[model samples]
Target: MNTPPNPAAGAASRIPEVATDASLVVPVIEEQAVVRREVVETGRVRLTKTVEEHPETLNFTLLHDEVQVERVPVNQFVADGATLPGVRYEGDTMIIPVVREVVVKRMLVVEELHITKHEVPTQESHQVVLRQEMVQVTREPLAPPTPGPPPAS
Candidate 1:
């Protein structure tokens, strides 16, 4: 088959082709995410403690101890060289023995003392001051941070 001549091929053949050794440089671009955290004060809390005193009247029962002593005469003779009796107690009364020496060189019982104790109760009133503690809580607002130089780019 017979082929026709192409016009674009003839024009490409007429242009002079130049030879060069120069290199081409291209820059690459990248994108990244940045994250940061900072501490900030919003408000403040305050605690207050106080003590209060109040006068009060108190009532109580008081106990008092009273002692009574009585002496009784007893004429009794004991054997010679007998030992003296010691003090003894009967219920709430305490008995003490008294002895004497006769002219016949014998021991004689003279008198005895009986002592008793009693407790008496009475009502009494007294004035007293009592202390109490009180607590109060309050919230305070904090001022914002002062303006400063802008961050570097």
Candidate 2:
């Protein structure tokens, strides 16, 4: 059988239809946290050295050789072809007698000062700690929205 063409039916089809269910179902929108970590410069560390001088006294023993003079009066006559006092060994020291026709002045000498330098090695250690911020995500279900009145018929 042939059905009548209805203009209202065409218009109704163009419009969307609504569901008759009493309870409406909808998707709930949610947001979550994303955690990310990165390395960054928080601060800086520097090492500096300073020098200061102060008066200090040091005592040390120093060994050195020096000349010593001793005079003795001997009224002995010297003849020709006779050996005079010369350099001779006396234990760990050498003794030399300088004979002259006239008396002469003599002096005594001694050791003075000695200086030396020394270098020493040392070790140093330093430690540093770094920190950063991170993001964490958590999710939970929520209650649905309240239903509204049905669409106009």
Top lDDT prediction, candidate number: 1
Question: Per-residue lDDT of 1-153 in model 1, one digit per residue for the tens?
Answer: 889989999998986554576555558999998877667788998999999999999999999999999999988887656677779999999999898888987878898899999999999999999999999999999988799996665
> Tens digit of lDDT per residue, candidate 2, span 12-119?
998667678655556899998877666644544444444444444444444444544454444443454566655666554555454555333322212211222233
Show where candidate 2 strays beyond 4 Å: 1-43, 52-55, 62-68, 92-95, 98-153
Worst 10 residues of 1 by lDDT: 16-25
State the displacement of the C-alpha of residue 31, model 2, in Å, after optimal TM-score superposition.
34
For model 2, give the 10-residue run with minimal summed lDDT.
Answer: 106-115
TM-score of 1: 0.64
Residue pairs with colliding backbones in model 2 are 35-135
> Which candidate ranks first by TM-score, i.e. highest?
1
